[model samples]
Target chain A: MVGFEVDAVLGDPAIRIVVCCGSGGVGKTTTAAALALRAAEQHGRRTVVLTIDPARRLAQSLGLTELDNTPRQVKDAPLYAMQLDMKRTFDEVVLTHTAPERAKEIFANPFYQAMSSTFAGTQEYMAMEKLGQLRAADEWDLIVVDTPPSRSALDFLDAPARLGRFLDGKMLRLLSGTARAGGRSMFNLVTASFGAFSKAVQKILGAQLLTDLSGFVSALDSMFGGFRERAEHTYRVLQDPQTAFVLVAAPEPDAVREAAYFASRLEEGRMPLAGLVLNRVHTSAVPELDAESSAAAAARLGEEGDTARVLRVHELLMRQVVRETEVAAHFTDRFPLVPVARVPAQPTDVHDIAGLRAIGDAF
Target chain B: MSWPARLHVVTGKGGVGKTTVAAALALALAAGGNRVLLVEVEGRQGLAQLFDLEPLPYAERRLGDIDDDLRLLAVDPEEALLEYLDLFYKMGRAGRVLRKLGAIDFATTIAPGLRDILLTGKVKEATTRTDEAGRRLYHAVVLDAPPTGRIGRFLNVTAEAARLAKLGPIKSQSEGVAALLRSPMTSVHLVTLLEEMPVQETTDALAELTALHIPVGKIIVNAARPPLLSSRVTQAELKRGLAEAGLPTDRRTVTGLQSEAHAHLARQELEQQLRAELAHLKRPTVELPLLSDGVDLPGLQHLAALLRPR
Candidate 1:
């Protein structure tokens, strides 16, 4: 009734990259796995799904207790999955850019060290780097990704560019000022701060960080350029029509609004919009009683005092369903045309491949 | 414990100005003559930027003259990792090699919830200091915690990870950390904006905190939008205002007896969001004005002024 026709988007071959994105706890990761499963089993294409999420629940979804950075072959023909280890990958890239010595110096440098680990955009940039790696591998016919559920998902687009700017930014130059014009040593005053920090580091680690920093910087030198250039390539790859951005959300107002924001962002950035997936949809045809009836049932159970907890649970579930319904309606009104596929909530946690398969069959 | 040390932990959602708030609050408590140690996990160095100082490392540094007693430190994970390692085995040379290979990195970085435990460990150590300084070197330990989305998992990391590692330093540390988190002296503050998602997350966060036995001290509703209209009004007044403003009339527009009927509808929506949040019945709520820009030192000071016990 909301004009969401799912087949039209799914059957399109040009829809190469399906990005599953939404807020946390809204089943975004599970939905992504389902979509990949569907594409492989139903659509008959080899698919690889990459998740930028830090949550370790991916193993539970894939019927495994844990996963690593490498792609694990889950089922037959079309599905392969891997959780992106951004820091490890970034470290690898850093090692490729500069000489071992220079890389060590750079990574050990206090400023670069600070920016690499804790800066905001690094995750986004690293995600792009992962995308670039996957797109170039071309091992799969389709590539899917589950993005981090941050308010700034568009950072997926802006991250690489931001990183490039930062690497070339005045901040680096300011820090570099501490290095001689020949890039030999830091300025005198900064040396004192580093000295204080180093003393603290020595107090804590007994001069081990100095040695590790040296090794890390040396390895990072060769990897820096590759990381930057590949980030740029990923940015361009996302802009291509082959990369279809699927914005996933729940029926809730907040979830739909986040999806709407993502869609608007894709439009603003000229990124392709493939479709939308609305998971955990609830319908009135649940065969459940209305609120008044539920209240009566709860009161009756309480009066009998035999099954009071059961009746209370039923009432709570019913109320939650109604609220979920309201949230879903808000989403329907906002996103009009992007093909939306709805997956209803299940009675239990998705802990096995069978569960994932049932979710895939929702469409 | 005297006044400043009486309250121990400070926490809130990320990007809601937790680090800034912690910095300013530390400064305020220091101004009121208390030794405060502002700590951060996940190695963000946000405190350095907040105080307009050079970058802070794993060790604590005095944030001079924000107050004489106010101090800040960003506990580095690598440093924390070393101390943790040193407590158990001699890292001699091969241990250093293992650390370089990121063998120990898993303990801090990739380990499920271990980082959170270590992070909380730093705060707990700061809080429990009975050193002969008798000065109570840190009367308060303000922690810049992770964002709300993953905070439940962050704080509960110790208990959850401890379940996996039955008998190791990790387990012992986690158990010790969990005790401190569940203790009464620690108070959790949830910082959220007036927006739909943040408020919703705040509610979920409150439930999670309560379940974990973390006493939520207060809900700091950051960047709250001003009330555009009063609740007491009739349909006629709404219609007259809408007609005067030459706006379209619709059922959704509150009968359009006033100029801002449409805005009233929007306001009603916000109220609904707030109402849904209040349904949880946890902790008192405080509101702050929305700022034109992200919070800085001056802005944090202003916010701290509001947070001061009236």
Candidate 2:
């Protein structure tokens, strides 16, 4: 297995986009920020980091009061940052792709509002949308995008198709027809065509709201292909050689499986995986003190003494290193082709610019 | 935890041990002769993998034994949707018709409010069910729910009810689910580890769940590293021992000792911060020590013992 050289990956002139992906709580946002900072400061590449949820860590590091859709320049660093606002991104898409009246209709529609914000795959879709926008703008030399640590790594990959299917579904066609028909079509014509299906929907949503939903759909009809095409474009950008997917995972069994799952999923999609970032790896300073030796030494010191207590702590530390190494070995053994970079757990979480820079230096 | 709520929704940041906590909680409840049903709503089949049992399908299957008192179910979204349709709408033969029309996929995957409703709806159904003799079919139902990021929306389906399915059985069902979620009968427990992100997410989840009127229960801090040092051993003493260990201390060996001491101090420092952050969440918190070799079937049983009431 090749050992991952973070410097080489960050400094590569051919690489422009780095995507940090993994299951949740893997320090993905931090990894993305660190890589972006490294690429900008060390590699001298102008960088912009795209994150779904930065919380306070990114804000503090970037020296921003808050993040919005527009990429804000990070203070005293050669990097830019923004948190994805899914609804705003969706609204921008609708406003840009459709007429003023239709945009108003969509923005006002409750169903549209719900879908744009809380729908299962909307954030994933908007993340891709925003990525496409950032790349198309060509404003930054390196764009680091952080995807949602979804329940499945495939959720973001599958969103475009699911969205296309929903938009192009027969229900939308029926709803749009009824809404557009505006009571002009014969009642029997509607009954004969939609009968049970419309009946089920009408029973739940009532006539007025269903009409509103269908109106929203028909208004969005002109932009359906545009959205799908953009998804394809983003999908292509991800597949490009200039792009690298780094899977960040903790030194835990579940996190290891998650990383492996993501690796294979990326492979299936033909997306280029740069390597695996094994975060929070427990490494020993005293690797020479074998566990057996440490335990024996502690036993000799007696259990109650201060020195014995130190050995006790030493044994715990030894056990942690042993476990973390096995977790790393599990990854290397499974996907030996993927290079692994280990980041030893820090004394504190990364909350500021220097912390992110330290992470950059760690790998 | 005596007579823990009938429906326990275990959720946390992605890496937190939600599945382990759910399985352990089920075992803990079942130890008292309660017929507990553990459901994996994320569909990871984590239960089957954790217990080393056969993979659970959409239907409930006996998972080895939590003393014959626990059953496992991986709530497949599609199957759950279909069953909901059959039970509520009595769609019967029309289910085939609906699937042929791609309605099922649209509902489960494409529809925003509908998707969460379907997932939460299944848990509600399982928890509220009864047998022919009028006794509860399952004494407790534990759901390894969606992570903290999505739990609020998953439980708060009322928005969808009010907007999409405004005035029908679906709306009422959504309201009923929300009510069940808010009631004392249900507990939305946030699971986390002694780490920043997980603790941060747990705190955030607690606020969100409380804001949504969902009963926020215990904060489970999982995978904590047990302190191996005696209380009296100071950091300096540990470093001193590392410096003077009974051996020919070479440069590499000294560096190793230094690294161990630094890691130990860092860990202890971080743990203090994480514990303080968790305490600020204002919920009763239970800490589960990090198990060696990573949590397995036996480890899960031991974890269950931890969750058990004294």
Candidate 3:
């Protein structure tokens, strides 16, 4: 509908993955859908947009009442989409890498379960796992993912490596008796902390906590490399050009600052960034008959208090614009090469596919 | 009823409806005739939205029947820094320089885990604030804290920083803040959904908070759905309801059958979650009804009523 030409991020036909990442409430899901929609409609590729946001923001955008771990086709767009159930994805990863008995053993472990579901990088790691699965799919030509709002959006790429580092780190190895120093244990102090911690943990969790932790850690020790290689593979796929990363943000100060931080983080990591999609930006192109002018006109038309009302309205709208401008500047100032497209704030929530298409038009 | 616990720190992961709970609690407290201050840090400005007011700033704005008794303050980090410096170090010139340099914002944003210290510090100030006549103006202060994931690290950092900054004003203040935080008088309320991730995170958050000696008051499970499936036939009927609603189907995805299967399994999972959560948390567990529409003011007020003394 517009004169803009869409650029292929990965650039290689063989590369069919796109990762949409940024801070919270930045329309990451909308951007991912637009990209997936474009890939399907323009390139004639069957695509899927996956998200890890528990808010179901993308699911709402795509007009899905509720999305599970499984991808579903929506409105004949020749695409499939889903919000990755993090716990489900983690379970799938465990099942794929470990035996059923081993998986059960791992799941039964309290420490392992806690780390899998509630730790800082769990969502990021699960997202990477979901991406890997989608990339390996035979049916879809393109797979688009929307990552979480944490600073660790890309950290899942390093999760396996980080896990390996964790295992190799003094803490775990010290527990494993692998870091033998002078044939004496170096984990006495840590062990004591762990003992006090375990007792506290046991008292809190009803005395079976350490048993679960030991078993879980043991299972993790056995199947560590497979998980690492999977993570490393996802990282490589993400770094590839065919897998373009679009950073989404709103024109709000906090949202834009987060986007700026994310962009810089990506730049440091040398990730392939496609562009920035600044959603819900308040426009300055409204007629001169805005709150300020309208209020003045109202007062002049014999309503004394009307002018104050109009000025107050204008002040509010103006603040909105200023916030947007601040956020926009933050993005453009940092990433000069990356293009930014603005989607004006809608009066209502984008809960339908038509609304999603309207957002998609901005890209 | 036992002094209504001096301060209630309602915290959870972001977007778990902390501000909503805080608003409701204030209204409930006021209904029970206690002057309260609903405080929010991290500058989310969510309280104004909950109260259906225009976006609020650092100033305490009075609203509703709760007003005259209850006051709401969304603590601005910059204002908190000025107050802190003036009250503690008495550094008038240095404060201006720090404000000009955006050092206050920098401390809130860039540094590792300092935002928590600032946030906790602000909440502490609110809970401890007295009137000009040296009377305790607020019977209670409800803090809408950061989400559960960060709360543990947030509390731990101040205690950690106290050791690092030992002998300075920061050390003394950090230790003071830590004592209040760990005290039984302050209770942390975790808001969660009935879903897997939230339930699991609640458990983890509770464990972490307990380890830090922070007392948990209650668990407010938001957006909890009633059971849709009863008997096998009812489950089948539920599946039909979903299928008629325009869910897509393909050879691989038999939308009717597969979704029902997933939904059925999900129901069982939610049941397990309920059992686990109730077993774990000894405090009063309040189940908030899922709203058919989005949660706006009326919905939050209804929720607040549920938490009130009947």
The DockQ leader among the candidates is 2
| Model 2 stretches astray by more than 4 angstroms | A174-194, B1-3, B230-255
Among residues 3 or more apart in sequence or in different chains, the pairs in candidate 2 whose N, CA or C atoms overlap within 3 Å are A285-B256, A285-B259, A285-B260, A286-B256, A286-B257
**Rank ordering of all candidates by lDDT, starting from the highest:** 2, 3, 1
Could you tell which candidate, 2 or 3, scores higher by DockQ? 2
If you assessed candidate 2 against the hidden native complex, which CAPRI class would it receive?
medium
Candidate 2 similarity to native, TM-score: 0.93
Q: Is candidate 1 or candidate 2 better by DockQ?
A: 2
Best-performing candidate as measured by TM-score: 2
Q: How much DockQ does model 1 earn? A: 0.03
Cα lDDT for residue A14, candidate 1: 71
Report, to 2 decimal places, the DockQ of model 3: 0.03
DockQ, every prediction = 0.03, 0.50, 0.03
- Model 1's alpha-carbon lDDT is 0.60
- Candidate 3 regions with alpha-carbon error over 4 angstroms: A1-15, A54-68, A149-164, A180-208, A284-295, A302-319, B1-5, B8-144, B147-310
Which clashing pairs does model 3 show?
A10-A241, A10-A242, B12-B147, B12-B148, B13-B147, B13-B148
What lDDT tens digits, residue by residue, belong to model 3 across residues B1-310?
2224778888765445566777777777766567788887755566775676777777766676333367778877677767766675565666665554434443332223334556678878778878899987677888877677567876675654532233445555677788898887688888876554456668888889888888888888775654533323233443333234332223232333333334444554656556576667776677776543445667766877777766
